[model samples]
Target: MRSLRLAAATVACLSAVALLSACDPEGTDTGDSAASGAPSAVPSTPAAAKSPAAKSPAAKTSATPAATSPATPGKAGRLPAGVWVDPKAVPLNAALHWRAPGPAKVLGEQGKLQIETLCHTRRDEYHAEVAMVETASLGGASGDWKADETIASYGSGADSSGVIQTTYALMGVFAQGVKDCAATAPGAKVTVVAEDVDHLFADVTLPQADGSTVVVHEFLVSNRGSIAELTLRADLPAGARPKTAWTAPADRQALSDALGKPACTAFKDCV
Candidate 1:
């Protein structure tokens, strides 16, 4: 497939007080490496509904932030045949510790959303996996933040070579989504902070009406045929923006790396 759009949340999580979020996108289905945002378009999930980086509808979550779980290596999980992630089994490593987890809602049989890349016009192309889940906490103060994580699994039947090809094709989708975002959002500064072959991190700052700004950082990583996304959405008040406001968080890289840990043994052989 070809040509992708990073549309807003289809069943995406919405929250102004969320620091982190997990979204499945819904957009163009022309597969093979697309955009990267926060919704569940089969091709992408990096931004929001209205603007390229607008406020998406967050998945249901707990009111308070969950405590950080202890990091444990080798805690890497196993991939059971045709089985997705187990909310109860996902261990909390120093790298991935979203203490508070919301209910996991799967979307894909209906249609997967796209994760737009490039920040220019909010148009991105990121091909997603089979099952997609968007999640996040809702309702909170402006200064506070919430978080969520979305993962796309290609399933036990995916070929490693195909998964590798898809990952390679999507190398620059997130960076492109940043450019697309800047094209539309006024005074909005969206930039790719860090990236590698299988992962990307970007920061988006949008000026608000009351002299405030919402800074969102999205981190995505791919393994085999799976993509795990960790996003941070924060509302910074005027005169309170820190110098590090536009930079990737200290643990973003680590968090992203730990996402596809202990590769599910199921992917070792993709004949």
Candidate 2:
């Protein structure tokens, strides 16, 4: 009976040990599965978007701006007809007078005269000087009229002041020696007209060939000596085309440089 009892106790101990081993294995496997599954949940976390910030350098490159174009020429405004100065219109020191033969009546009495000095020309071919003459057209298109006349100095300003001659068939004041300028080429004539003249700007209009008007602004220059440096610009009526034979390069840069600004090619890129 004693031997049987001892054998029974040993059998019980063996069974308990087997059960414990089975439970330990199950617990270890469960722990390993939970640890493995944790990595997948990390991808769904809000912190996942932090990766984009780490690559931020590429984002800034696309935001940079492009270069801009320079301002167009003849942008200031149109010229004022007659003299730029009314008080000092005609020169007090300089003795001056004018004459035109054959029923050319003087329209307005030369009063409150104004003269803005223009000292440069587009081409280096000739030294240029100009004065805005205060007068009107007597004969030609209109019978008797009041208009601004431009007195361009082509012959030597040093010459005795009197009737000067010009090749240009201009009704207003023109250079006296355009014919002399044409020695290089006969039948070559240059006519400059004031399409608009004002102290400031509105819309600038250019005449088109198809009886239409295109608005374009032009720039001008002024000098330290108000009398010495000046720029000319105009705004023509819409649908009025420039005469085919009459187009001039708006040599603003050359004139501006000769007056006070930086130099550039005349009439081409400046505009």
Candidate 3:
């Protein structure tokens, strides 16, 4: 059970799509105060596969001009071939509404794919509104990439037994930076409320130099080689903070389940 918590916390920390930083495996600090917003001495970029280094296979084809594009009578606004996940895959909530998927960004060299969608919710008579970015990634090589090695890049350190500890320390730096805009910036505070190897849950409060505070809840999950990240952000509210726990979507299971359908069934190699 403890391992599960660590996995979940790690996933939440790693799933922040907008704040992608490279991790180093060797330079991890193993101390009780490691989670106290300490700056990691490790390099920012990890040695694992860099998304920008890999080229997408789909980019080789030329797209037709919009003026001469063929219109399908029944299908409008559909994603071009090769993209995975749709709005239906988003989790439902009474207070939240799902937005359409954003433009797909292809990492040609890594053959990885990324797309984002937003879930919007309003706060107390429109004083503030929260927008959660739901980001998902599909790995290349038919999802053969090493999940552990990829995760290790985000500060797993050299001690295999302390994977959870190192992950929390590394993630603490990231959460602090996200709320305060800098890891070492003044008034930045991050609390690792819960974590595991595959998932993470964090409560971050960034007190700006301007006297305002930004609070956020971050959740992440990784199954097989695919990843899903959700970040909930809003103004610091009085009283208790809102919950931001998340579970993997059913359709996303295809990436891991060998007997299940793959994300890109149309591709022969995906099978």
- Cα lDDT tens digits, model 3, 145-206, are 10110111111112222322323343333333333333444455566654454444455566
Q: Write the per-residue lDDT of candidate 1 for residues 1-271, one digit (tens) a residue.
A: 1222223342233442241323224333523333354334446553443344212111110111110111122422222322223232232222333354445444532222223422223312233323233433321234544344555544332433443454445434444555567666668776777777777776677777899877666666666645666555667788675332233345754555465552334344333
Ranking by TM-score: 1, 3, 2
Rank candidates, lDDT, best first.
1, 3, 2
How many collisions per candidate? 80, 11, 25
After the best TM-score superposition of candidate 2, give how far the Cα of residue 238 lies from its true spot, in angstroms. 6.1
Candidate 1 whole-model C-alpha lDDT, 0 to 1: 0.44
- Over the stretch 3-112, how does candidate 2's per-residue lDDT look in tens digits? 99999999999999976654334444334535455422234555534544322211211121100111123521112232222211211101211122122122221211
Of the pair 2 and 3, which is ahead by TM-score?
3
TM-score leader = 1
- Candidate 2: list runs displaced more than 4 Å: 1-203, 206-219, 227-238, 245-251, 257-271
